[model samples]
Target: MLSNGHAHWTGDDPKQVYAICVASLAPVVVDHPQSLVVGKGDPATLLCAAQGNPHPAITWLRDGTPVSTSQDDPHSHRMLLPDGSLFILATRMNKKESDAGTYTCLASNTHGSARSTSATITIATLHSQFVVVPVNVSVTSGQHAEMSCVPPRGNPPPTLSWLRNGHTITPNNRVLVRQDGTLIISEVLQTDEGEYVCVATNPAGIRRSAPAILDVIVAPFWVKAPRDVAGVVGGRAELKCRVGGEPPPTVTWRRAGGQVPVGRARVVKGRGLLLEPLTPQDAGVYLCTAANTAATITANATITVLSPPRMVDMPGDVEVEEGQRLFLRCTVEGLPPPLVYWAKEGSQAVLPAGITTTEQVYLSHSEVAKAGAVGGTKAQYEVATAGRSDSGHYVCGGINSAGGVMARVTVHVRPTLPLPPPIIAVPPTNQTLPVGVAATLRCLVESAAGVGVGHQPAVRVSWTHNGHPLTNSPRHHIRADGTLTIKG
Candidate 1:
């Protein structure tokens, strides 16, 4: 036989509970509280303490588990000596997880176990970031360019885009998108440079990286070489034009004043418009025009060619020994080839009989050879075995092809010979004598009359004292002894 049990129990004796609680109860307190603030890489401390009737034993636990001391693990935690307060020694904690938890302190003794409130332990990752951008980037007028966008960090990585004047950039044949969120542009024209923005996006939020300015640096076009040109009267010069740009700059040369013909100009490739054998007609400002990719540029330069060259050193009359070579040097300077003609005084230069003349030519020795020689330009001429008859004035006249005078020089030569000195006689023969003392000196021309000094007059007699010229006085006169005397 089975019987179901259903019974009603009465409350325990209230007096019996009061006697059990009185046997096991202790007061709890915190003497030194723990709170800390530290940098990401630095260490921190959490102090939890209490005082009781009986000395209490303290223990530290993180997230309800005991902290272990392991040097190998970077996220490990531990406590060393001085147990009452917990020491969270030197360590790194991941901010995302594993490091975010509560730490509790439990103090136990004979009175009973009294647990303190829990505290949190967090490991913050370091935050250090910056940005970079390009200042000035230039390309040719009709070339290509690329823009870039970069960021320090992002959760799902950043998506890069370009904005021009606050508007999104769409790709075309001229625009290209890169994996690193950079923009590649083809045929970057001069107008492309200005203000632009780099946009970076992620699920967290859309962040614009920085502002980048595009500067389409274009090379100069139709550029003239020199700023100014100066020349003398009746001379000629030229101006140069060089260009820079894409699609190859096409150069066209023009004169400033009017459409003057490019006369006597020899054009050489690359160097510039060359004007040889220049004249006054070639003086003026010149314009150079250049075109590239439907764009045009112009540059101007002034040029002035100088007139007939003035003789820095003039040619004049001169005398030389009869047997010596007579040099008739005449310097005539002028721009272009000046016609140089040599002639004698009072008559046109006539070649000596049996001596033939080379074709009339202009000579420029140091620099390039002149254009001459009847058929072509030859720059040399010479005459040899000169005689006394050859003594006369010679002329070098420079004339332009326009028959205008450029420069002229005249030279005159006289033949002579060195003379042997005249004989001399002296009454006294003693060698040394003081200056200003009376002395007799004599000279005679019995044998060497025709001999002269420096091929001039006669042997000269001079009196000098201390390297100074001394004049003849009544006391100091030429004596019959041919000696100069001073009466001292």
Candidate 2:
């Protein structure tokens, strides 16, 4: 083609034609000038030029696929240059590992076709680093334990998941995953103790770490009476021990000297020991033990007994008022139970208060008070009257299997008071008066001597006639005991 708008050809001669034929017979050659550069998910282009007769047409193939620019679509396009160069818009498909392969630029003309060496464009896939998250784990009953998941290395960042006992443990109140990729188990129960795994996955591959096992141990507790005890004659005492372990515990009892058990003693077992009817011979060291495998623990209990109190005898001679209530009590303290009794003093083989009698016997002041008795610890007597019959001495006695004792009290009652003498009236006389009614004044007394108030006359009377004194000497009337007197 020429600018003349018409086909213009020269050198039609044999030599000229021969030269043109030779040149047309030569094969087309294509060359790519620039190396393609592109990032993931971006476009790139490879330049290719071809020289040949009739202006060689150029075509491009990527990964064996033909490149056609005639469509005018961004995803697939091409441009034919005046110099027979080929330009194609290689839109980046999803960047992926599979997008790497050979790309060839093919140029062809009427003479022949030629291809440029492959300009391979590799699209790298987005990748993340891999990390192995380490789990920091511990377990206890009703407590929280922490675990972690991490990868070796990654750019897009890997996802972390935790597993326990081969099962995926979800994030919850009981199980939690921290921002730092740590797994946490809240309220770690006995069942929570187990093996755990950490798994990390990415576009490249998936990885898992070694399983971690956690064992939880629980401590034991005390549950029984003391194991040891000691006691002497006439003393108070008790026995105790302890039993402790996980899943509770069981308790049992045994003799220290390995002797067969006998009566007068009772035993209870189950995290503790029980004793009944303790006595002087029963006093000694005792042992209590508890065991449990779940808690992997055991414990022991020890008890000691001491001496008994000495016994004291009751006193003699106890006095009380006629109608007053009375009571007598015996005092004793010891490891073993003690018996008590009461009786009258100076009585033949005295009865034990209620012994051989139907009424209940009182051993202490409280017991006596409950019996409607008017006395406390000491005996009391009610005052009926002041009479010789109301005075006497009484006694309270106490007796027990260990010993006997007694106490004494005295009581007194007094008599009531009597009336006083009568008043006297007299008439004055020149001289001494004759017998009775011969102008004489006198007083009559009825009280006994030492029987009036303060042992003195409660009433007195005086005689007067016209405010004049009577005869100095007059026969005097007096009652027996001299407590009463009269003028005649």
Candidate 3:
């Protein structure tokens, strides 16, 4: 007999008959194809292996479609090897017919058929040119600098790096390479100036950007600063300032808190600021500024205009009655602000005895005093509740290194006079009334003013009934203006 294309003989005698039997089994994959990545125009291979009762036949499929092997078409680039592997002579990069996709192998025999796990095929490529490139840039020393780059499209996205004058730049605290492929220098120095190039690299190839030039400029600095100057009124003054920088800087002059004097002030080309016939208003802080493309610098100097101390507001004579307040005012103006003091006549010592003198008389420097005109210091001497003994000749004096000034103020304290007594101008008249009727009386008194310069004398009125002083009661009402009323 014959079964499954194999011969088997059986007979009555066991020693005369011979039989051969073989078992059938479905195919099982032992090795599946592996994923692979290859450059365009490069060779690739996908491997598969299986075991079964009958020797299995192997075939390949790409993206769920059967692949054409060299046996089916001799001109095809893909071939099936005897060892159940797929070989490609050359990979194609065409958009529609590319040799890159998912692939799998099928193994079959008379018993059954088996399929293998999918494997992926990838093609790597990199463009030749960059999308964005670095360019020339100019910045001052100690300023920020940046260069941007966008690498070409590539498989596995390219990495970016920077090269300065053909040498790789290592990232440090000041130099950094950002995630977006930008090179940044936090504070650029003079040595950082050079030609820069951007490099892009990937599995396929490396691409370099065009060279970019970086220029570092020097900022303006002071070579010689102006010095403090002292000038008398109607005298000339000059101030000089010198500067240095890579690019020539421009020099200008200005008053710190005010504008430079327009007519009297002049700027010399190589020299500095010049002022002819200076005035008292020219005394202030002056600034010399030097500016360039890189930065701006400034220096200041004080201009002091000297003038002697003179009285702007003079104190005059004052008179007051006993127990009255008195004040004397004196204001003086001078350069450096003269110190002010008050003293009584025939005394060289400062007034109020033993206390230090200041710009404000008898008041602490921080105390608020009466405001005087601009450039003038005001001094006031106050006497609270004066008496006859307080009368004297007071002098207000101001002194500074420039000169000294003095002004006298006479003060008189007159004695207070006594107030005259009140006299009865109209006497009360007699009134007679019957029972349950009211009686009215009228009284008027007058008083004379005091002889001194003070308040007037006050008069008070009262009534006596039968030698007894009358007061307010339910029956008797006293008005505020000294009027009396009786209720019946």
Candidate 4:
């Protein structure tokens, strides 16, 4: 080998000779250090990887020591990987108070060395505690019930739950729990009567409080409801109801939203609503209510007050010839309907205004309907064949639970003609028609052929329009069919 900058190769030590342009390397740590906080008895990981032209080596240390620096640790807890990273180089599993401290990660290469910023690792202790106690709940049946539980916060907030009768039921239509740990029952029922317990749970453990008893008393109820009743005037009426509950319930009665008038004859309170000697005003709706310490129930009924009968459309005395048929018609309106009859006047006959009819003949019973509809009941007496002996004083009577009504009509027997009122076989009503349309009007007659002994005269039907006779015209015609027609 030449000494002066001139290369003269000598091969005695060939391994000592090398050729290179140039190589420089320096490790640079990751720009940031991570501070770690994990639960005690848990594992923690730290990273200190570096970058350089040549791959850097990773090393973890505690308080600048290559030896174990963890307090009271028996052995090293680190595991280094081939890629220059480790699970725990100076750390241990199941970390304790002594394991919580500043740690450093160092990386090195042929060019230079680098180190990470101090990382503070902390091991947190977690626990849960009882904060509030749920007490025994006593709520009346059919009332709102509310219960709650409170627990001290943990590392994480604990989950809360409520249970009944040792079984956990979720919040539903009947029961619900709020985020604030309140269990609410909108309407407490018999099924809600049981013991309750509050349960608290966290990662640390679970705790259940002592059972809190829930008592739900039975609510008052109506066993027998008041039914609608119809009572006669000057009669007695009564209403009753049966109530049962855990505690004796109070019962009261009212009429038409007001108190039933109290009197010796009308005792309207208590269960028995006695309307002795009821009047027309005593009829109305009534309410009966039952109440107890738990709840209340009500029952109601209608009271229909009835009145006496009254006669309508009475005829005056009549004169008819022998061998004539007579038609006796009478109508009466009253409450509770009535039974009508015809009585023959005798030497000792007398009439009273109550429900009493003596020495009478059965005629026909009438249909019951609203008095305001058509007429009331219709009672008709017809004599198909008659003689001089048929004439007499005839009394028509109607009787019901309220009272009686009667009317008398007298007749004379002679060879005289007695005009009879015309009864319509066809009734007429209004109608609408186009100007060019044809229309008809009909009128039929009832026969009174045997009404008198004399030869009867022919009957005639006349037409009237605005008080003037409607005569034959180009648009109007009368036919034998008793119809009036108009030509279109």
Candidate 5:
């Protein structure tokens, strides 16, 4: 009998018949094959798993074509494992066969058939030689160094690394590797010189590039340096400097902060710098430079030129009034600044005036006053008040280690004289005047002696009658010489 779409047996005849009922289900993939990149002559495997009511059978397809299994072809390099996986004995790429393509797995049973996600199989390969390789390099110590290389081509791109002298190199603070497979070293030292090789690694294998060499050179250094020299004008001076280096350094000379005198200064091959006929302008700092391919070095020396004392400014003759201020200037120039002194001519006594090494003094009418020196180059002699005793030839002398120089200046002081009252040498004599009769009065005047004519005061005489002044009219007449006449 059939009940609810299920079969049920109720009678048994001779022998019993049994029926087994099971649920029907469609195939479902549990595990899918993964993509793979296998090197040449290397084994590889791809997995596929499924579950269904009828226990689905597994198979693989390559580019829509069923793959031949080991059971189907005894000599086949591909095998179907019992766990529903595909295994390749040895991957290859040749005219006869190539195991490089897209692959998929199919599981099927009586209920239904199902397909898995597609997967690609690629044959891995790597070139034997590098595309770009490092070459020999030469550099100076404390300089930057660089080496670059491009890895070989492969199915999966190869990674890059570096080796030095057959030992692996690890990047540090001063050494680094760029993303483009370049090695960089900052401030390279002598120890960094070695054989360098680029290493390329991939699934196929590891490939090494040709060896490259690195050479480091030493910098120039001073073996002997120059020293300060003292020279005199119209004399010769020499400064020596010696240097050593790996490549033989070249030496040169120059003046610091100024140009060397072209005809007076030159560089001597074996002895060093030579300066002839030295002048005041040539006294300064000089430099000697030694240079090489690696580095440059310099040595310095100072030249001190001595010269005799000379007067740059001298006082001139002057005439001043008595009781007036007087000033005299004298300036001297020399290497070691000279001391200036003032003295009067024909006098053994030197006035404590002018610039001294420590102080300066000014000569007053009666005494000497001390003061500070002025500007180290100029000297001054000052007199607060001029007197007749100060009128004489004054000498200014400058003395230094080199020599001495002197100059003379004359000064005259006029006396301040007092004017005497007008003297009545001849006064008007007693005279008698009468009406209708002419009377004459005479008056004489004289000015003090030694008074200049242009500076004399005006003198005038007047006549008075009973303390009253007289006028020049018809009754009284006055002459140009102070003679008065009266007419009635």
Candidate 6:
């Protein structure tokens, strides 16, 4: 204070307060806003402050647009507090990748507005995504095989490779990976079948593509041919083998030295040989052939056929009338048709020589196949008018180089029924009655079975008075029931 004269100032004086008070200045930055780093949907803030004669107003702008206080908008929201500070309520980077940009805070008043430097915010989409899906592929052998893998580049690009049996495959002359992430195998083979997987990698993360299956069709091949087979006489024999290939090979059975239908050999199903009623002569090598358009394979196996005469048909007990003809038959199957002989069980005499017959009880005329004709023979014994003396047990013996069989036959003679005598079942009875009445006499008789030179013979009835046969006159009436009615 400069007084007119040098006067001393006292407390609580009104004239002393009338001193000088001055206020005049533009806005001055107290704290400049700093850059910010945030993720999508995360809270962010930019600090800004300015000291001015009239307090400065705080404003926030992103890409030169004023930010709204409402967070529901599609942009970043910032609220300016009374203390000249900018507060980002919420971020707008949640929608798309375009939200990643610079953000700035401005402080303004009656003076000029000043904004902070750009805040380079990076909102990374955190996950890895696939664009191209691999697919399954099939190719024939000797053809090229390709397993494609095309995935869109992501935050971190992915790597592609081929895997077989869960292991990464190494590229050789015939197999290699193309530059565009395609697995290529030239001249595909059966061994080149597997799944190809593509893996994507980037700064964000790693991802894998769906597995692509590669299938290669191969030709047919046989692992084994027919093997040796052995069978008993009159027994069945079969030969088998193993086969391996694509589109399985067809197998056929053939004899090693001779054609099929030789002796008693035949093809069973499609894979083996069926030899029935085998003899020692049937012991030889056989071949099983497996073939396809691509390749053919053959294998040999030996067959041992044992010989033993086996009875295929035997006569059961024969029954005939006393004067009826009888024939007993027996059949046997052997490697070679065996000699069939007939004999009586207890008689010391040998059976007479008879004609050789091909008729078998079990084998009808049409049922004799080539194998049956070669391995079987039949015999029969005929009795002309069988009688009581001819009823006896007969034995049939079939002998072959391998073995022999015996069959017994029992013959029976049917007896005739004895004739029965004729008798009267009911005799005639006399009846007495009063005058002017009718009298009836009844007579019944029984005829014996198989008698009287005819079947079911009926007895003749006669009515006689005083030992005379009665006639059917006007006074006497005869009934069909052998009753005579006499009226007096």
Cand. 1 TM to true fold:
0.25
Stretch of 10 with least lDDT, candidate 4: 366-375
List the candidates' TM-scores in order. 0.25, 0.23, 0.37, 0.33, 0.41, 0.26
Clashes of 2: 72
Q: Which ranges in model 1 have alpha carbons more than 4 Å from their true place? A: 1-253, 260-280, 289-296, 301-327, 336-488
Residue pairs with clashing backbones, model 3: none
Give the alpha carbon lDDT tens digit for every residue of 380-448 in model 4.
666654567758898887787778999999977665566686666895568898888888878776657
Higher-lDDT candidate among 3 and 6? 3
Clashing pairs in 6: 156-201, 156-202, 156-203, 157-201, 158-200, 158-201
Candidate 3, residue 380: how far the Cα is off, in Å: 99
Q: What would the per-residue lDDT of candidate 3 be over residues 1-488, giving only the tens digit for each residue?
A: 77876666655666665556677879999999999878888899999999998989999899999999898999999999997999999988786688889999999999999999999888878898899999988788889999999999998688999999789999999999999899999888866877899999875677999999787667655545788998866787888887666788888888987899999999876648988888777777899998887778788998877655677778578899987887777877765567777888887777773332245332222111111213457777777678787799988888877779998888999878876676777777777778777666666666674232354435666777789999988888666445677777
Q: Model 5 segments beyond 4 Å from truth?
A: 1-22, 219-488
lDDT of 5 by residue, 408-432 (tens): 8999987776677778678888866
Q: Report how far off residue 63 is in candidate 3 (Å).
A: 1.5
On a 0 to 1 TM-score scale, where does candidate 4 land against the true structure?
Answer: 0.33
Q: Which stretches of candidate 3 lie over 4 Å from their true place?
A: 1-25, 140-142, 154-156, 167-172, 189-193, 216-488
Q: Rank the candidates by TM-score, best first.
A: 5, 3, 4, 6, 1, 2
Ranked by lDDT, the better of candidates 2 and 6 is 6
- Residue pairs whose backbone atoms clash in candidate 4: none
- True-vs-predicted CA distance for residue 144, candidate 2, Å: 1.6
* Candidate 2 Cα misplacement greater than 4 A, ranges: 1-136, 219-488
Please count the clashing residue pairs in each candidate, in the order shown: 23, 72, 0, 0, 0, 6
Residue 96 of model 4 has an lDDT of 48
